[model samples]
Target: MSGAAFETIASLVRTRAGIVLGADKAYMLDTRLGGLMRELSLASLDALAAKLRAPGSERLAAAVTEALTTNESFFFRDGKPFEHLKRVLPRIAAARGPAQKLRIFSAACSTGQEAYSIAMVAEQLGLLPRLEVLGTDLSQEVVRRAREGVYSQFEVQRGLPVQMLVKHFKQEAGQWRVSPALRAGVRFETGNLLADLRHLGNFDVIFCRNVLIYFDAPTKSRVLSALADRLAPDGVLYLGGAETVLGLTERFTIIEGERGVYAPVVRMAAAG
Candidate 1:
């Protein structure tokens, strides 16, 4: 691909998704976009770029953005976060009044594993009756798959415990399908984190893990601030190990002893 073609595609992706593709990722563009090329019957990457530049190319632009967005995820990824959740559920439950629901948001939740894992854990702990797990991703394809609650044998094996698997999944035609009871109250929707999130409502726990690393500093700060605004008082946020709110925004502070967990900062009142 010519330099001009590369830049045009990269610019469209960044504008549409807030994902910055550096010069080193030129090869990634070629590999990821190959399928789109074939789907569009384009002769080369340059042809695809030309199509993207044409008028009324919103659909093509969306295809390119989806192609570039990474969707890698597994059940209960990075065990520590789930472990912490198991320990803290009682406290979150206690804070809620009778019949009140606890909300958990799995932001950028690719293919729904993380959200389903949380639902499984809550069910195991007897908290599923009062919990709602919302899994959102930018890709419509992944969101639809997540809502289906079907997983391949390989997908089921990753980070999903054997006992839980036996208890929560039913094997059908070689794929593991999440039990209907386990699927209750767990919803999946297509959403962009960089867009307005107020309609999603406040959450007691928000898992925006591993997604912020793709954004530039300004976008990161803006996204974090928006998350903070959506967090209920006493709510907690979990970020990826490599990501943090430090120097990005002052709206949150680390929860001591909890790796990757953060709480909204509380400012003390002035002395009388």
Candidate 2:
């Protein structure tokens, strides 16, 4: 890919999905966009860029953006976040009245593992009936798969415990299908972190793990602020091990004794 071609695609991705691509990642264009190029009958990266520049190419641009979005995910990834979730859920439940429903949001949830893992935790705690787990990703294809609630054997084996697997999944034609009980507790949608998300409503907990590493500082700040807006006052936000809020935004403060856990900053009213 030429420098201009790379810049064109990178600009589109950054604008639409808040992902930053450096010149070193130019090779990814050829590697990741092969299927998209073939599907669109595009001859080269330069040609794709030209199409993206055309006035009627909004759909092509969206396709390219989706093609480049990362969808890597696995069940109970890194263990600690879900463990913290186990402790936090009951506390939140204790605070709520009998008729209230608890809500969780898994931003950039990839293929639904994180959301389903949350469902499993709620089920284990006997809170599934009163819980709602929403998984959102920028890629439409992954959202479809997440809604389908099916996974290959290799996908289920990664970071998923044996007992939980047996309890929540059943084998079908060499793949595992998530139980209807779990599926009923969760929903999936296509969304972009940079876009306005107020329609999703406030979440008691938000898992935006492993997503901010791809964004620049400004974009990171924007996303963190947006998350803070949608989080309940006492809600917790979980980030990736490498991602943090330091030097990003002041809308959140770290939860003491919890790694990668944050709570919204409480602003006091002025004295009369």
Candidate 3:
């Protein structure tokens, strides 16, 4: 692909999905979009870029965006976050009155493992009766797979404890399918973090981990602010270990003794 075509494709992805593609990512663009070209019957990357440049090419634009978006995820990814959650679930549950539902959002939930992991934790804690887990991602394909609750043996093996796997999943045709009880009360949706998120409602916990590294400063701040708005008064926000709100926004303050856990600054102030 020519420099101009690469720039155009990068710009389209950044504008549409808030994912930054630096000059070094040209190879990634070529490799990912190369498949799209074959699927669309386009002869070259330049031809695919031309389709993207055409007016009323929303379909092509979406295809490019989906093709470029990273969907890397695994069950119980990063032990610390899940460990913190296990420790804190009781506190979150205790804060609410009896029979009140607790909502958890797994933002950028690639293929639904993180959300289901949360469900598994809740189930182990005997909190599933009052818990609701929602997993959202930029890719509709992943969200659909998440809803299906099927995983290859390899996918189930990653970060999924053997005991939990045995209890929460059943082997079916060489793939592990989430148990009906474990699948209960968990939902998945396709959404963009950079867009309006008011419809997602407030959450007791928001797991927006490992996704902010893709955005530039302005977009990162915008997304963090939006997440702050969606957090309930005492809600906790879990960011990637490398991501932080310290320099991004004052709406959240890192929880003491927690690696990726945060609470609304106002809530911290009130408690103080």
What stretches of model 2 exceed 4 Å from their correct place? none
Evaluate all candidate structures by whole-model CA lDDT and list the values in order: 0.90, 0.93, 0.89
Better model by lDDT, 2 or 3?
2
| lDDT, candidate 3, 143-238, per-residue tens | 999999999999999999999999999999999999998788799999999889999998999999999999998899999999988888888899
- In model 2, residue pairs whose N, Cα or C atoms come closer than 3 Å (at least 3 residues apart or on different chains), thus clashing, are none
lDDT of 2 by residue, 108-147 (tens): 9989999999999999999999989999999999999999
| Cand. 3 Cα-lDDT | 0.89
The TM-score of predicted model 3 comes to 0.96
Instruction: Please report how far candidate 2 places residue 268 from its true position, in Å.
Output: 1.3
What ranking of all candidate models by TM-score puts the best one first?
Answer: 2, 1, 3
Q: Among these predicted structures, which one has the highest TM-score?
A: 2
Best by lDDT: 2
Question: Once superposed on the true structure, which residue ranges of model 3 sit more than 4 Å away at CA?
Answer: 267-272
Candidate 1, residue 61: CA error in Å? Answer: 0.6
Task: Judging by TM-score, tell me the better candidate of 1 and 2.
Answer: 2
